[model samples]
Target: MSGIPGANRQAPKPDAEGAGSAALGPRPATLARYLTIYAALWKNSVTREMMFKGNFLLWIVVELLWFALQLSFIGVIYLHTNRIGTWTQWQVVLLIGASHFIQQIYQAFFLINCTNLSELVRNGKLDFLLLLPVNTRFVVSLRQVDLGAFLNAATAIAVMAYAARQLHLVLTAGHVLTFLALCLVGVWIHYSLMFLLATTSFWTIRAQGIVWGYYNLFQIARLPDEAFRGVFRAVFTFALPMLLVSNVPVRVLADKLDSSRLPLLLVGMGVACGLVSEWVWRLSLRHYTSASS
Candidate 1:
């Protein structure tokens, strides 16, 4: 039995004789759990979207505007400096494009995952997920999907490919593989960072700064890490490193960096973020004074 939302009353559990109780057991595939959460959430989001068709188109237009704004920001940079932090025009394009690329992947493919943190915390609905017969992380992360954001990511990839061609860069097999890997790492890092931010909502009850801070931090991706010297470099490299999220992929693809520790950095950061954010999630559960019975 679990509590119903809003009513703040525990709902009666299905009896042992019920099929839901008897058929459901521990799922062996942890990844499948994550995907299932996403599926369920996406189904809900689609239903939500249908309630406002005009707003859905507005959301699409808004996302496109955001993409255009980012590109325009890069354009403004080129006007002042021919080369930003030693990166050529093509490199800057790729760098910005890569950041957008990493961003799009998540927005496009994993929309519901982003909203789970807030929904779980605010609605006191997380307990239902906790009762589910699966790994909680997978359950929580995949509770929703956002197709609009996913489509945005797809467009970003297409743009990245076009940008790469204009740069006249001939990517080697190793380079291509490495670039793809870095993009993955970048997405993980960004996700981990957001995860960290979202968990903060458990304490703050509001997540305003995180999204804005991430957007501002993303701007740094347009400039090469080479431009940030000394202490500033250390800040980005270690404390909240956008280097891994956006810089590494572009650098590797641009042939500026032959040996990047970005992948290792990503994995290490991912592990660290996952472990800590998860720890926070668990701690929050202990602190969760749910009004729901």
Candidate 2:
């Protein structure tokens, strides 16, 4: 017999102390690791989209046509009047460009991935995502990209540049930086709202209706902020804040914002929405019943 009982048997099980230490000691993925993973994901998405070259080109053409039509409509409106709610043709064009920039970037980076979350939950694919050693929110937000939408964003930037030139608006470095920051804040607001809506899938197996409703509501943001008044203004300005999404950035660029604190308020609102969305997502995860279960 061996000196120890079952000496040739399987290796000894970890002791309680050792197991507890191991359980508590593993480090989470670092920020750099997360960025690396996201880069890989984006590379794969671009590859997949490129594989369907015809479809990609078709989408690009369709988006360009739609944008052109929007510009034509704006031209018609300006034909009858010199200004719409104190916004000149060029200023309103700038606003439209800003709206398109925000919308296209949101769609390219976050919309598709976030919308798919409901499907992942419905089919229990989210379980695999949960098992991955990464930040669930970050992974969920950036697993895909729409190259065509990025092309549209570039077009919007060109339009804004043209409008700035036409208006003879001198854009300082500070003005440009502030506009870009506010544009990002607009994107964050859109993502936060969409994520919150998608998380409703935890309770309602198919929450696409809510997503569509959000699209309908957000369309109002495409118009100039001065176009709304009274209850409409109060509702979109304070309650939902769709107006603030593109309007604040446009105002900042146009040098039309009267109050210095308006930008701060916009930043605060975006941060508050993002934080609330995160909390709601965690709460929804707790309520989620995996398809396997």
Candidate 3:
């Protein structure tokens, strides 16, 4: 809105020199314009990342080590017992891999942007971003991309492949596609919840602790949902829905759908979370007091 000039004015009369080109070329649609903007943002991010190749590579190694620690924790549990709540070792590995993949995808695309919301608000940097000629939420939620996090997600995929082999799971094209799709659903659930937490910055001085706290909650996602009991299970599976994220997709691959309705429930939860996050973001914008004001 701020970039567009003379919204009420008619199209300007073209000079004879460029009249033919102006008449033949149509204006880009709104969605197309936004897509182009997002592409440019990604390009800039990639360019900046190239300038810090060492840092990028270092982060990838650190994440891989972190993932190894998680797998080691699972291995320790398996040494004591073969299964945790009806899930075999390989099945649990697959679930943890799915959780890691979802978490990385969310981190790569959205986490840094959402986390920056608080800093933007604190320093009044958000005022300029809000004035950009695009949806405020879109600008805030997708201005940065972390290639390291995205590349690190490949480790999870490799682990999942090994687990699938151990479980003797059939890997049909349809099955693989469904698994990936469900993983994306898991990512959406994370993005929505994290975005909601980040929006708390509109009221508080800083909400990074709250947002990072939510990141720590992903540990629960890697565990078997059945291991949780009573109110704890109920709250995570439905209220927060964190347990459903990786568990649902892993169950589908392992042919362990306890209820035929689990998939439907997971999809419904993703949609509900997305809608709630959007509504809350718009509401929070109204409360934002720019630095100048």
Candidate 4:
């Protein structure tokens, strides 16, 4: 339960006599206002997730195992050849850690509801979203927020920082800004991919295999894009390309991408992917002949 705007507590809706007029502010008049609903809805979601506190602890355990595996992956690769690719051990570690950080933003900030959205569409709960006062896209994408995954994100920064220090990397404003830009693009690309996957539910009732397989692609996110060469890189570089979004951010720090130089090209790719994803989402909406009245 959420508080009536003027009510003293967080419980939903109060009597007019106790909480003043029942009428709340008119529907959000601007995009910014409607976007705020994401935050409000997220707060409610946080409460819901917290109610199952055991699951939160289990998530933390899973996150620990996840981080350990990625780190150990880099370790094993280094032992085999001292460097499986051009990157030194530290560079590879930084890439792995940075990938985790980026992955967290996607999972925590955007992918939560979108990934599971197919269920709502299949079950007919989606019709209710269409009738809500908020923007349907916003409502659908942010129906919930998962904060448990954020622990992985938080731990990842520490890993990234340690790796950066080992490599003698120093941070600069230009690097930071370029990284932020790439991160935004990366988040969008990630969400867009998930959105496109969820949209399949509009036509099909089951897509669990499709969703799981797509997510498994993130395992490749920790590697430098250049490690993929020849036809493999060509295929991944554009078609189903996780490389452009993940490795691009790592390169921002490694300076494979010169911030002083072609910053526009890197971000342009992100924007392009995001736009295509949004277009696909809208197209899916057009096909949504609701399962329920």
lDDT minimum window of 10 residues, candidate 1: 1-10
Q: Between which residue pairs do clashes occur in model 1?
A: 37-142, 38-142, 41-144, 42-145, 107-149, 108-149, 108-150, 112-144
| Decreasing TM-score order of the candidates | 3, 2, 4, 1
Ranking by lDDT: 3, 2, 4, 1
Global lDDT of each candidate: 0.64, 0.80, 0.82, 0.70
Error of 2 at 43 (Å): 1.5
Candidate 3 per-residue lDDT over residues 1-293, each given as its tens digit: 11221111122221233334433545455445556887899999999999989999998999999999999999999999988979999999999899999999989888999899999998999888766545567777788999898777988999999999999998788778878888888888898889999999999977999989997789999989989899999999887898899999898889998676988888899888877887787788778898667
In candidate 3 the C-alpha lDDT for residue 51 amounts to: 99
Clashing pairs in 3: none
Model 4 earns a TM-score of 0.85
Residues 1-293, model 4: lDDT tens digits: 11111112211211224223223444333434544765698789889988999988898789879888989977887887766566788888888877788888788766767767788887788777766544466667767777877888879878888888888888898887777667767676677777778778788878655776777778777777767888887766666567776677777787666454334555665566666766777677778787775
Across 149-262, the per-residue lDDT of candidate 1 in tens digits comes to 766776677777878898888989998787877787666666656666776766766664564466677767556787878887777777777766677777777777655476
For all predicted structures, in order, the TM-scores are: 0.79, 0.89, 0.89, 0.85
Q: After the best TM-score superposition of candidate 2, give how far the Cα of residue 171 lies from its true spot, in angstroms.
A: 1.0
Model 1: CA > 4 A from native? 1-38, 109-116, 208-212
